[model samples]
Target: MANSNLPNRIIKETQRLLSEPAPGISASPSEVNMRYFNVMILGPTQSPYEGGVFKLELFLSEEYPMIAPKVRFLTKIYHPNIDKLGRICLDILKDKWSPALTIRTVLLSIQALLSAPNPDDPLSENIAKHWKSNEAEALETAKEWTRLYASGA
Candidate 1:
């Protein structure tokens, strides 16, 4: 599809994302599908996932701006808030979503989630339990997983 057919909001947003990307984050629309984006987020320093590069997919539906963009992790991560299938348990991505939010905000939120994993509201019960039971071990596991899968090498 051509940019001529896309909504002005999407075009502006895409331009802003490309021109002024957020720190440690990069997002670009797919050449084949303007509505689909390929995203990469570098793990925050001091976090268990540090030095890792996580990939994600974001797709804006036809009702975008009114509806939250569909997003999912393409890289494996060992975190309580992320499930085995990479589905994330985040309020902004679900019930708390608002049209005012943008893709930059969403990706920033995901990076924050990596910095502060909320085991209390988790997507993976087992990981959550592990987090609650033995946090140090859980952090080590998360670090190991990041090294193994999200090295970006």
Candidate 2:
């Protein structure tokens, strides 16, 4: 889509995202659709996902800002907060979402989630049980999944 056709807010945000990208994160709008973005986020250091690169897709609907952008992981991950289908269990992505939040904030929140997985509020029941019962083992499994699927190799 042409820049002129998009909302001013989208244009400004897209430019800002390109010019001043967040650390360990990259988001670029698709040539075919300005509302669609291809994103990459490096796993935070000291997290089970460390040393891995995760891919994701983010789409801004016609009701963007008023409605939260749809986001999902393209890379396979093992986390209690992320389901097998890559649907995330983040509050900000759901009921806690607000128009005040930006794409940068949402991505940052996801990175923080990776750093602190909340098994108590999980999207994957089995994984949550594993996390609650044996955190060390769950962390190892997460690390192994990251290595196998998100290594960027």
User: Which residue pairs in candidate 1 have backbone atoms (N, alpha carbon, C) closer than 3 angstroms, thus clashing?
Assistant: none
Among all windows of 10 consecutive residues in model 2, the one with the lowest summed lDDT is: 1-10
lDDT by residue (tens digit), candidate 2, 31-106:
9999999999999999999999999999999999998889999999999999988899999989999999998888
> Which ten contiguous residues of candidate 1 have the minimum total lDDT?
1-10
Best by lDDT: 1
**Clash counts for the predictions, in order:** 0, 0
**Model 1, runs deviating above 4 Å:** none
Residue 117 in model 1: lDDT: 100
In model 2, which runs have C-alpha deviations exceeding 4 angstroms? Answer: none
* CA RMSD (A), model 2: 0.9
Model 2 residue 121 CA deviation in Å: 0.9
What TM-score does model 2 achieve against the real structure? Answer: 0.97
